[model samples]
Target: MRLGSVIKVKPEKLEEYKRLHRNVWPDVLKTIKACHISNYSIYYKDGFLFSYYEYKGNDYHQDMAKMAADPKTKKWWAVTDPCQSPIETRNEGEWWAAMEEVFHLD
Candidate 1:
């Protein structure tokens, strides 16, 4: 499976981000699924957000580009984008930092 990661910060206000994600927009959900992504998850630590997604196709970069071009994805990003910060240490075009997998218990 292909893997990807993203980062977002804890909102300055109370429970705003959590609430928004609790019912993510249907169009946004559809856009992600259309991109051939599945088994998605997000985690938080030390006030940093980490997202993981698995892809099941050969054309990852092209699919990601399509996802970015989607209007729904753009709208979703407009809302959730403010909650994120790019990792300062990553190379350019890296919005999320990649995590090195150390172990897999499962």
Candidate 2:
């Protein structure tokens, strides 16, 4: 399944955010893969960060829950979350607002 989300980057921390992502920790990467998330990529523009990833797991919620329950992933988010501003448009419980798939071919 293809998933997408959007969040805002604090203007002052854009460079630092990019730098941190450029060197994402190995354990974090491993955890993500272990969760069956692939083809994950984050793009930045106009102070907004958009993330897209393909979930190849049998259960999306379970996989995501597993990832969230990981210690290393928690540490990683502690560092990264400070640089982000949850968009106001996001749902009540979402740090990154879920985006709808408008169109896709193939």
Candidate 3:
């Protein structure tokens, strides 16, 4: 499955965020792969970040919960979350505003 989301990046934190993403921790990458996420990418434009990733797991929510529960992942978020400003359109408890895939051809 494919997933995508959008979030606002604070202007001041943009460069730092990019630098962090450039060399995400090895353990963190392993955790993400363990959660069945692949082809993950984040693009930036005008202070907005667009993220996309593919899920190979059957249980999406459960895997997400597991990812969220990981200690290292939690620590990672502590540093990254401060750089993001979730859009107003994001629902309660959502850090990234999920997007609808209007079209896809493969």
TM-score attained by model 3: 0.97
Give the count of colliding residue pairs in each prediction. 0, 0, 0
Instruction: Looking at model 1, report the run of 10 residues with the lowest lDDT sum.
Output: 5-14
Q: All candidates' TM-scores?
A: 0.86, 0.97, 0.97
For residues 1-106, write the lDDT of model 3, one tens digit per residue.
Answer: 9989999999999999999999899889999999999999999999899999999998999999999999999999999999999999998889999999898887
List the candidate 1 regions with Cα displacement exceeding 4 Å.
2-14
Model 3, position 2, has a per-residue lDDT of 91
lDDT agreement of model 2 with the native: 0.95
Clashing pairs in 2: none
Q: Global CA lDDT of candidate 1, please?
A: 0.77
Better of 1 and 2 by lDDT: 2
**RMSD after Cα superposition, model 3:** 0.6
lDDT of 2 by residue, 40-102 (tens): 999999989999999999999999999999999999999999999999989998999999999
Worst 10 residues of 2 by lDDT: 86-95
The residue pairs that clash in candidate 1, if any, are none
Sorted by TM-score (best first), the order is 3, 2, 1
